[model samples]
Target chain A: MDFNFTPEEEAFRDEVRAFLDENLPENGTRDMEAVAEFQRRIREKRWVGFSWPKEIGGGGGSIMEQVILKEEMARRKAPALGACFMGLAWVAPALIEYGTEEQKQRFIPDILDGKYQWCTGYSEPGSGSDLASLQCRAVREGDEYIVNGQKIWTSIAMWSKWMILLVRTQTDVEAKHDGISCLLVEMESPGLTVRPIKNMAGGDMFAEVFFDDVRVPVENRLGEENQGWKVTVSALAHERSSISEVYGLTRSLERIKVLAKSCHRNGRPASEDPGFRSRFARADARIEAMRLNGMRFLTKQLRGEPLGSETSINKLHRAQLEIELGELALEIEGGLGVLVQGDSAVPDDGLWQRHALSWPEVVIGGGTPNIQKNIIAERVLGLPKD
Target chain B: MNFGFTEEQELLRAEVRKFLDQNCPLEEVRKLCETPEGFSRSLWERMAELGWVGLTISEEGGGVGLGWVDLVVVLEEVGRSLFPSPLLSTVLAAKAVDLNGTEAQKSRWLPGLADGSRIGAVAITGDEGRLDAAGIALEGRPDGDDFTLDGEKLLVMDAQNADILVVAFRTGSGEEDLSLAVVERSAKGLNIEPHRTMDLTRRMGRLHFDGVRVSADALLGSAGSAWAAIEHLQDCAAAAVCAEMVGAAEGALKLTTDFANQRVQFGQLIGRFQGVKHPLAEMFIDIESFKSLCYYAAWLLDECSPEAPLAVSRAKAYASESFARIGVDSVQLHGAVGYTWEYDIQLYLKRAKWARPAFGDAEHHYQRVAKLRGF
Candidate 1:
């Protein structure tokens, strides 16, 4: 029935918050210096892979503690760890669960100590939400697998040193989910190219990665042949439950609250209006709900209940909530909400309006709302497939 | 920081859901929709008997001391059945009183509310404004031992069945000079006029107090401070309403998915087509998102966070918009059959339309959110 942190958890939160206060770079920009400093902090404090097992050079904390850290970091309005989320949350977990001993030894410590950055090469132009339909080809060549394909919206590819890629290894298999296999590919290998994509958020966060006969050691294969779908699914499950969306929503709520108080309506403070009061109540409620939902999901994971299709529910809700919150900020700002970043007339921060504009990426990226719904129907409700 | 329910709460939810499934089925909703009063008094009493009505009341007040999350679970089931009762009004009124009322007032009103003997309704709106207690023009002049009340309250839900009406009034000339008073329906010079609304599943009325006399003790809480109490009650109620909307949205989504799987079009079940499936998928997503927001809002209320007002607004606004959109899409996916009154889709649509506008519409809440966030 309680929602407050225990004294120990609270103390841990304080400690983390204090550390962030001292170590977080003062530069507000998400520039290379900020990224480098963030990586350095991870290396200095070993906070990058808090969820990884102790054998992998991590603190081996509880999942709740990981969630707590994420929430606390977000509450302080700190930037992401910038240590390759794909490597830590996705690839590393998959490796722990299914990788060979050698693969784990080679990859885990490198990722944990921030020596390597990883990008996920799951989606292509033809296969986005329908990831099982990937057309990427990887064929065995002696002791190596020659990889050839293009991955769209591959985040941090330009910054990453390695990639956990899914490719079609056996073309004539019975089912799409069965024929694919996962491989670890070196980003600096010959014939590899990375072209950065400018996102609406005004960041070059994603890239189009091309692998033209890039030679990866066969020992880099993540699991058995024709089992890439399972690995991919497991990785996605980790991503969904990681409470990353909670961080984003928390930051958005804080930004919105500041906007509401400082914004004026007719001669009085906008916060004084009954309408404004009501809306403030709602935004706060949704963020709290998202936080609680994350906790519930974690509880379920701890209890060994199948995570199931409910993660889709969390992703879907968070995307729409973020959009609505962004849109609400714009509405409150009136014309200012729609102001571009460079517009001089805007006050406080032009980023609120920018946030409003960039809100749709959440809904469109990851798994689209439509795709998440199908997952809920087919997997959660067990509705008959047509 | 636990968000998952304890086994006891889960058991309670299961029990309530089972009871609603058996007794307050959709057929009962259909029958009640056609009846004069949208809700059944006998059923209300039965709920009171089962201690459902008193679930949120403190143990000191002759009731269970469950928190907001527990109430949300019960409300969700009530919503799933579309059960017509003053459950929402009674619970909200009880909450308002609990939060602000004097010991005497609590002792006088809570037992009846807990046991369903004295139904209550809140009158915070007039014809033009929506739940703005400040806009009330109701005047109350002090007499020897009582006050003479004069004003009208519009769109009071379930006022016909309520024995006591908690009316908001302006005691001073200032916009914030508002007060709440408990006026009995049987009082002289009082008028109750029931009106038909968009959703027939809930009842609404206008209450006119023309020189109605009430004792000084009739005030629910401190005169001007009633606004804060009312706002708190409204936020809590909004959370419950959003939870209900989430329930209805979920039901509508399931119904549409079932229809899409079974109904044939173009020599195939419509579910196979992206046109039909995509929208249904989107609706499912919207419903899930609404669920998370709704649940979080409820949890926030239980935690009593200072940020609760903002969260409640977001939850209601999102749920209202999502539920209305999902209701329309569900009907559209069902084709001609969904258009008919007998098809049950309209029932959900009507409920959503009613619930969405009850406390505040989506746009209204969004604007409020804008102001809170410094838009």
Candidate 2:
């Protein structure tokens, strides 16, 4: 297979590089003014939602071009594509795919413009991995749906203005996956409350959101009632398309290399220690494998084949890799690794320490490793279900 | 940026798979294992006629000039079938000659090796069985228009079946002062003794080079300068071995998975139990990931990328451990019958045990990876 891109694709890559050169500062310098200006320029070029259909105010770029754009941006360590993280990531895709024309008109522009943040409302205390068995209830009124639910691990919920929520509209059904409905609920809805949760990393990025008979317009319902499962599944599908997470992982690897060269163990650079060196090399190998796996998935997508449980392979790798990389870096730093960000003795500003503690966000969120393993076993391998 | 094989490569894989399925089944391999050479000469000629042996040889060398990507496709199937042949050793010998042989030397050796009219084997490791400069203690003393070879080469693959041997020798004291000498197996003063191996699908031999003399022209490259070529050959071999390991592991997993799907315990298919199924899933994941590494390593070698050495070690190091693990798990999942000689699973486990250490064991490659990555 040809690993080299076509000349035309190379030209697009060149264009992206030139654009980044002009707008993005060297050494990954960032300030609010520069970041805002860069976003504006990229949005003007319609590169924000580069792969989304053009009819929806997206760049409508080819998948390959989108990859190039992302590669260039990531190589330069630019800020993420849009300011509204979850909104631009999945919410907009779901809205575009399942939102009513009126709903699209109301929310799509706001998402594209990064006007406000959106958080997911999927998991609950009882519904972490077995998500479809969620017990959150929504009862349809005359023209609105009254929602009552508690969503846990709602990332960025405290800062988000809205939530893409899943609620059970019918209690009795043939299967647990049936009777679920998706709603675009305002965080300001009368009975809704968001309490930020302090994770082990001592960060408040995730929150527990509660709803007590919150009123949501029936029009805000995404897709048909009892079809939110389909909408949620499709929305998550969009998340797998780019495989850009590999770039982030690769960048982390480069940082680890630098830290290894600087940090000492046994009065020599840790990079020279047999145990540390082998561990780092193994990390490098695993990351390369993950990157190649991502490329394989991308190849399937480019061939017009839909990716399914195969994405779980990389997801499983990424889950382990995140922890592996962080731990490796921490071990290289020796005792100083225990120090947090503000400690003067801390290495890499305690980035690895934070990273080492951030495994739950990746390892447990979306789906746990066990869940991914089960999916791979049953769905991909054709093994009998557990 | 496509991470897929070309149509021709896929076709070659399928063709080899079909040919092996029909002509060189496990029973055939088992039968061949009982032979003196542990090789199937008829199957080797058939594969050669199909242009399998000369896939990586340039067209000018009297064979189809292709890349490692194409050769690996056939090699993987050969591995899957547990085919008993000297194809890998022959390819490695041919590679040594092609990479460092002079025009005259190339003309003297490549065509025969390419056409499978002559078999070849590599003698790199000595008594230590180490695949490094330290391992090549076979001394070669400079003489008038010739070099005198002395020392023992152990674990020489296909040595009994090879017409010629590419022997790595220490021409000087420096670690990098290693050179390759291509000597005919019939050279005077050379003794070949076959060694029994755990994996009977292939043969290994010990070569006692008692003052075996070869002309200066027999040297593949300049004296004390073959270290790089040797490393390159090892990378090619490692990458190829990784492909084979992936194939062999996949085969074992497939057999075990099928068994799980069919066998019942407690009135339910064993595959329905998480205990059985989860290990199967883990095996599948390892195979898939290792396959990616293997192919990527092949691609890197094909392009002669700077990353080829590291990638090769990565693929080898990872596959070496995982393939053995898969072999063990496959047997474990098969239950009592898995350990029986009557069962085919034993073939793969044996293959894995032998192949894991063939082209630098896991520990060696891991350390190589560290060195290459500038650690």
Candidate 3:
């Protein structure tokens, strides 16, 4: 029943808070430049992979400690380190779980040092949410495989140096889950091209990656051929676990509080209005609830309990709360909440307005709320599928 | 750092649930609602006999000296049964008297309250039933060996059955010049008007203290600093109410899922349809989210953190809105049968409707939270 941190954990949190206070930048800039600086600083401090094993050049912390670090960093409003993708979340875990000794030795240090960034190349144009139906082709020739296909929403493909990709190795298997293979494709390989896609957020955070007869050695394959479904599932599980829309919403709440205090409404502060106060309170409650849900998940992870379908529960709640917060921010600002980031005379960094405008992408990214609902129904509730 | 309940607490929860299932089922609640008292004295005695009445009170005063977590466990069970008793009022009164009352006051009242020989209710709301203590218009003046009380208190729960009434009055004109006085329910010029409420499971009454005379020793705490005690009482009550909402929400979700599995439509169980299935899933998610906050608030209360007030308000406001919505949606998903008086869905819905606006509506608590967060 205790929620307070132990004295030791509290001391550790204080240390981490102090470190973030001393290191994190405080100036405002465009997200791109901020992300670039964030990445560079992360590399300089060698703090890129907090959850990876020490043998892989990480901090060798437990999952709870990692959660604490994330919570503390977020509480301080520190920018996220750029390139938080397969390199840190997926490849690192997969390597620890299934990588050959040589593969771990080759990739772990480079990843931890930020020398190699990675993107997932799992979904093709036809795949989308029906991920097992991917049409990418790969054929074995001698000791190499030739890959040809296109991956949509290959996040940060232009910035990544490697990709953990899923491609079809066989087509006649009875089960669609089989007949797939996973490979680590080097970005420097010939016949590979990346083109950035402009998202609704007005950022080139995602790209389309095309592979045209690119050659990858047999040694580059992870796990086994026809086992790519399992690998992809593992990768997606990592992505879902890393989902902290709640953390982002917490930041939004803080920003909205500041906006309400400083922004004017009818010759008084916006916070003076009962309507704005009510909305702010609702947002605050949602944030607190989301934080506690995260703590429950973290506690379960620490106890080594199987998370399984409960991740869907977290995803659904977080996404809904985030959208609600966005809507509330707009309500708090009235017309000003709709102002764009670059709009002159806009207040409080326009973070809430930007969030309100860009929230649909969050709902669409990772997985849609409808899809999460289906997951909860089928997996968590054990209901019959449609 | 541990979030899981202790083995003892889990066992306590199981025992409480079992006791409530056997002693305070929905039929009993309906019967009590039909009665003029609006509560079951036998059930209250049984609960007290089981030592559930004085959970959070000090051991020297005949309580187990447990914390907020224990009270929440009991409250959740009470909510599951929609139990009609004086548990909420008595617990809150015990807390206020323990925290702020003088030794003489505690010695005079705690034993009787703990042993079920006496019942207590807090009267802090004014004529409009506003939550703000400053809104109270009750006036008290010291007259020799006694204080003359004259004001009307609205929406006092279980007042007809209470032996002691903790009345909040303005000793001076300022907002902070409020005081809590313990007045005997049989005091001269004390008038009680029983009223029917939307949720008949809990009793409500309006009390008018017309020049009621109380001894000088009846003042529970300092004359002008009862605001702190009243605030603490509000936080405790809010936390308990949130816990109750969590229980009701969980029950509604479970009942809806069971109905979804059993009820057939279009040649199959309607649970297979996305429309019904999605909302049910969302309700389950919302219930779980509410549980997290409720538990965190309970834990914060046990820790006695300065953040408890804000956390409790947040939990109460969120649970109030979420549970009410879920209750209504549960009935909608259950089809026409859910709306019938015989069906259990209405029971839950009624409890949720009453609970939402009891301590403070979602909007009221939300405003409290905004103030706490410096908005």
Best by TM-score: 2
Please give me the DockQ of candidate 3 compared with the native complex: 0.62
Give every collision pair in model 2.
none
Q: Which stretches of candidate 3 lie over 4 Å from their true place?
A: A14-47, A76-84, A139-148, A172-175, A188-191, A211-215, A233-248, A311-314, A321-343, A348-353
Which residue pairs clash in candidate 3? none
Model 3: per-residue Cα lDDT over A1-386, one tens digit each: 65677787788788778777666676455666655766676655555676555556666655656666777766666766435556766777787777889999998777665665798897778888788888889999999999988999888889888899999999998988889998999888999999999977778888998889999999999888888777644432222244245666767677778777777679888889898898888877876776677777766666666676776777666677667877766676776776777888666667766676676666777788888898888777766687
lDDT of 2 by residue, A182-292 (tens): 999999999999999999988899999989989999989999999898887553233353357778888888788899899999898888888977777777777777878
Candidate 1 structure quality by residue, lDDT tens digits, B59-172: 777779888888988888788778888888888777867777788888888888888898878776546537556556778776775678887778888888888777777767
Evaluate model 3: give its lDDT. Answer: 0.79
Writing each residue's lDDT as its tens digit, candidate 3 over B235-337 gives: 7778888888888887788788889888998999888999998988888787777778878888888787899988888888888888899989999999999
DockQ of each: 0.32, 0.73, 0.62
Top candidate (lDDT): 2
Off by over 4 Å in 1: A28-41, A77-85, A124-126, A141-161, A187-216, A235-289, A302-304, A313-365, A381-386, B96-101, B175-177, B222-225, B290-306
lDDT of 3 at B79: 82
Weakest 10 consecutive residues of candidate 3 chain A by summed lDDT? A234-243
